[model samples]
Target: MKEVRFFYAPEATITEELPQDEATHAIRVLRLQSGDEIFFMDGKGAFHRAEITLVTNKKCMYRIVETMQQEPTWRGHIHLAIAPTKMMDRVEWMVEKATEIGFDEISFLNCRFSERTKIRTDRIEKIVVSAVKQSHKAWKPIVNEMLDFKNFICQPREGRKFICHCYEEVSKEDFFSLISSVSQEESLHESDDITVLVGPEGDFSIDEVRMALDNGYESVTLGKSRLRTETAGLQAVSMSNLARRI
Candidate 1:
């Protein structure tokens, strides 16, 4: 059996040529020829098994042989709102790993102690696409531009909401415990969309935590040890993903 190369074609149809970027990779990098088989994903849970029909310097066309639509990996959407780290590589790494683990959306937060205030969603989104293709996941995660902490927490979100922080004065509960309790209570529904807020290196200010609590975000802890901004974000993603499974 030939190794099936997967290309992201969000607007793919039963009979159409691959997009320019995909075409370039298919024809130039992979050296795929006419009659070769490949798979295409629309990043909306649809996969198209296709056979290459034309290969040129600028175009790689295909005809769909079969279509498969996949179901969600777990119930509910996992949305992670995080403060971007000072190092761009760390943020990129988190996005790549999180996409592989499966999540619905990611948002950047501008917090009181954030090292980086601006985020380029365009660059991070490319990471998302690459990770989705490499993982062969049917769905692609949305990466949003950075937003102020107030704006994000104020936005109405459905399902459960949480904020992870490290402060001695603030009362907090273990994240896993809260997940178990919430799951038991809402077991009938597939799963409720979960939104988790992770703060920066210095953590959310006591005042900021107060604001989030006022706006319905429950304070939770990842564990005993403190975590960096990106690590905390990744951990929140892992915990949220695990919560839906229980």
Candidate 2:
């Protein structure tokens, strides 16, 4: 299995020395020696194979020897617009797990029900990076800055739009049910991207849901259970992936 590779975010192409933490971890923690083969495929969808050429107590350098591109040319993209939980740790966990399950975008919406008004981009980015490596996924999820719910509803986008809001008397379809239906409409064996919104702990406000509905967003449901924000997002992702597989 080519020893599943590792990649540096900045592509090891800078003139300056590697960051202290990165250097130390690559050398001291992973313990690579000169002449050992490895790869640092940049996150920009390119792969580079190399052999360790320089080694210090701090960092080990690799000489690029081979290059290739792997699978998943994005005809599909999972964009999850979500409300950040009051507990930032839960938000972190959501980013990490969602990346592992293959998400393309993490959008933060400051809705009426939102408990946390701010999101730390750096911390969330770290979680995405760790998840990409942990899950052996070549693609990382893009975590966007927080935006107001009303503003998000006005943003223009192409293709099918879905809003998963649990509301009474609104036409709601189970996420799995919708996934199955959407999959059946197209080539299931191939990828198809869709965006989903997971509301806050207090859930999406009635006004927020109304605005989304008025703007042509179809209402969808995860299931009978009222899930926490993160759980609902993952459930939707998992359902989409499974449906695509079918």
Which candidate leads in lDDT? 1
Poorest 10 consecutive residues by lDDT, candidate 1? 182-191
What root-mean-square deviation over C-alphas does model 2 reach?
3.1
Checking candidate 2 for backbone clashes, the offending pairs are none
Candidate 1, 49-137: lDDT as tens digits: 98999887799988988999987877788999999998999999999999988889999999999999998899998999999998888
Best by TM-score: 1
Which residue segments of model 1 deviate by more than 4 Å? 1-3, 183-185, 189-191
Give the Cα error of residue 81 in candidate 1, in Å. 0.4
Q: What is the lDDT of candidate 2?
A: 0.74
lDDT of each: 0.88, 0.74
lDDT of each residue in 17-119, candidate 2, tens digit only: 3346556776887777887776654555656677778888776676777766668734467788999889898888877877776767888999997899999
Q: What TM-score goes with each of the models?
A: 0.93, 0.86
What does candidate 1 score in Cα RMSD to the true structure? 2.0
Off by over 4 Å in 2: 2-5, 10-21, 56-60, 73-75, 183-191
